[model samples]
Target: MIVENKEFHSRICVDALENAKSVFSPLSSEEKQLLLEQMIAHEFKKGEVIYRVGEKPDGVLYLVHGKAKIAKAGIGGREQIVRMAGVHSFIGYRALFAEEESYASATTLEETFLVQLPFETVVSVIRSNSDFALALLKSFATDLRFAENRTVTLTQKHIRGRLAESLLLLHKEYGVGDDEQTLQVLLSREDVAKFSNMTPSNAIRTLSAFAQEGVIALEGRAIKILNIDELERISRLG
Candidate 1:
């Protein structure tokens, strides 16, 4: 996916440090305003590519609305989702720091709103603002921590466990449905496979098996949990 630097003009800008509070601690108003000046809001349509693998790294992109996935192509051009990103999170810095091209890709899972900060501009601000720099560091640490957990789940878990963990993650990131049992996100089977670290066919088969076991109830793209507690137990066991 490509991230184009489109100009935006707004009467006011967000308090960048407050927006970064998810990773950075609180900041002073002066610092927030200073950092905000370096940001530009960008809108992305659903299914649009944000950045492609091997593309030059440009900057730190933040999610203001909607969601996205950090992914990489696996064997045969299949994709594997490494992370799910939403409001207040940062994306597209893996290559920027190394001064190399991106190793993975990022794309909007839905119509998304983002704040794109040029890498050099942000680093310049960070150089002067201790809070901003620390926040950026914390963001990096958060990504790393999630990566470590994902490595364990994808590498060690059984198929059921992997699926369960993926669903749980979806529930956390996307939320439950009106029925309070169904996952809210409408992910394609391929996306599910990518997120679950399984082949598309395997994800389909296991989900079907779960249906047979009365672990879940499916309605086209909507999946309602029939026995979430048991699913959790199975995931834990795996």
Candidate 2:
């Protein structure tokens, strides 16, 4: 269930922290309590902006539920999706540790629940805990690597390859429905284009092409992969 109040938020936070079994696992009970005390839960509807470019980092925002996309506005107000954050993910943190304004904006892809860890408390915990600091550093490095790879993909991959890769990425992030074919997440064509670095018209045309070729089956906002092998091949070739 979605966390609605501070008490429930605290419980969910504890559960997420425990399940992380990384940084939070090593935290002492007192430390955990301290973090829980500092945390504040906020809910957002689909398409709501959580944070925007040039906004100063207030705290570390954790995705307690639902999904969000991190993107940066490019020429002509076109948005280039940097990454998609799923449940149990952290968003808008790169700017927090860097001590700078956010370079990207985070927006909810669906109704989302967020837990904000006050920046002061985060700094204090990291100062007191070397393990947590190290974990966060590792996470930052991993994100940098992903950004580097995405740069290569978006710049070099063909349109078909880019769209194929995006579908695969969405599948990995959100999984599939009960039928094990249709994707779990529902996204507008515009959002899909932003993720794939294409215009909405192009995205629509290519998706139609894929559908005609039987590479995928499209039903409104739903996309079902009918030929995973071919999709992977297209991604590989590009």
Instruction: Give one digit per residue, the lDDT tens place, for model 1 in 1-238.
Output: 2234433323213632455345534556665565577767777898988899999976777777788988998788877899988777878887888889999998898887777677776676678778667767887897899899999989999998999888888887778867899886778888889899988999999999999999988889778788889888988988
Best by lDDT: 2
Tell me the lDDT of model 2 at 151.
Answer: 96
Residue 180, model 1: lDDT of 92
* RMSD to truth, every model: 3.3, 2.3
Give the alpha carbon lDDT tens digit for every residue of 126-201 in model 2: 8999988888777778778888998999999999999999999898888898898899889899999999999899
RMSD of 1: 3.3
Candidate 1 achieves a global lDDT of 0.79
How well does candidate 1 score on lDDT at residue 110? 87
Residue 140 error for model 1, in Å? 1.9
Query: Candidate 1: where is the Cα deviation over 4 Å?
Result: 1-21
